[model samples]
Target: MITSAGPEEGKSTTAANLAVVFAQQEKRVLLVDADLRKPTVHYTFNLANNLGLTTVLTKQRTLKESLRHTGIEDLSVLTSGPIPPNPAELIGSKAMKQFLQEAKEQFDIVIFDTPPTLAVTDAQILANLCEGILLVMYSAKSGIDEVNKAKELLLKANGKLLGAVLNHKKAQKEDYYYYGG
Candidate 1:
């Protein structure tokens, strides 16, 4: 799961790019839009928002039925379907765990784009369910205190912190990209 201290930290963008990279390597990748409150994976992939994680969790659709394929081979996406009134409850429910288990078994890599750590408990909840959590922070925009706070929250939730991603870094040389660990 990819999350940050707050919004617009490039969590979704990082998740999407990582999913594509994994898929390009011939690995079966599943980009799950777990950001039920404010989803963007469907928009990023230009896919439908009809059926997805919410649908599966609510028992309205099976995991298989909710998955949509990207034009890139071996890449599938499970967009957040129908914004529900209770996002945190739905994400922390037993059904969400079961859904994640199933997804883990089905894909080589399951990349979840969740909400900010400081914004809600959704990311913390998902961090516990997922194997690891990647913290994304903008270069100049992210405050040190907020980043630390987000890290502390994840630790409290027993979420594995897999290194931080420094995003929106300035360009210096040809190899200098926007984001790096």
Candidate 2:
């Protein structure tokens, strides 16, 4: 999953929340902090940034060395290790591609928290990598023009654009419920 917006848009929070939902369903999920340019998944989860995905990508460390066990049982995380100078080059490299391939085989779902598409090429570079990209939008914050630009980037990448996830849904009408039981 590629969680991003222009900027200051709570992309990481959305991604982390999704991980929580998946874990609640008993799925073995691994969160990959692919946003090397500005990584915050680790911080969101309150995990260490000592070592992670960058280590695996740069081949300075192995996958076993980088994959850290979060407090959540079914969920693990690979943080963006030691922010590198060439984050775009690294993520768009052959090694990152190879790592993702192997990761799919190991975990049920691998969620990638990447940079905002409009802010940098990092998300666009990563959009090409994942099976699906989820465009996150903030209520009353994101404009149609910015979204359209992102859509264009998505088109150029040949990404499997899953759909948009509308966050911060404010209730305009009174909350209603139907009994299923």
Candidate 3:
């Protein structure tokens, strides 16, 4: 699962890129837009959002029936379908656990693009289900206090925090020169 302290911190972009990277290595990847409130995975992959995670979770459609194949070889996407009213409840449902089990059995990597930790409880709820969570933070824009609070929340939920991605860091010329070789 990939999320951030707050919105517009590159969570979705990071999740999508990670999925593509894993898929490029020949791993079967499924990038799920678990951000039910404001889903963007469908937009990112240019797929339809009529049937997706919500549909599968609600038993309105099977997982296989909702997964959309991205033209990017081994990548598939399950967009947040129809933005349910109770995103947090839906995410925390037993059906969600079943969905995760089914997804893990099918894909080599299942990346969930979740909402920001501070914005909603949905991320925290889903965090416990994920094996590892990656918190993406916008370098200058993200406050230390906010990041710390988000970290605390994830830990309290017993989520295994893999690490954090510091996005939009300006590269120093000297730093670039060191790696230019």
Each model's C-alpha lDDT? 0.94, 0.84, 0.95
Residue pairs with colliding backbones in model 3 are: none
Q: Give the runs in model 2 whose Cα sits over 4 Å from its true position.
A: 175-181
Among all windows of 10 consecutive residues in model 1, the one with the lowest summed lDDT is 172-181
lDDT string for model 2 (40-74, tens) is 98888888887999899999998888898888888
- Candidate 1 CA-lDDT value: 0.94
Candidate 3 residue-wise lDDT, 42-160, digit = tens:
99988899999999999999999999999999999999999999999999999999999999999999999999999899999988999999999999999999999999999999999
Off-target runs (Cα >4 Å) in candidate 3 are: none
lDDT of 1 by residue, 1-181 (tens): 9999999999999999999999999999999999999999999999989999999999999999999998999999999999999999999999998998898899999999999999999999988888999999999999999999999999899999989999999867766454552
Best by lDDT: 3
Angstrom error of the Cα, residue 122, model 1: value is 0.3
Instruction: Count steric clashes of candidate 2.
Output: 0
lDDT score, residue 105, model 2? 83
Residue 78 Cα positional deviation in candidate 3, in Å, after optimal superposition: 0.4
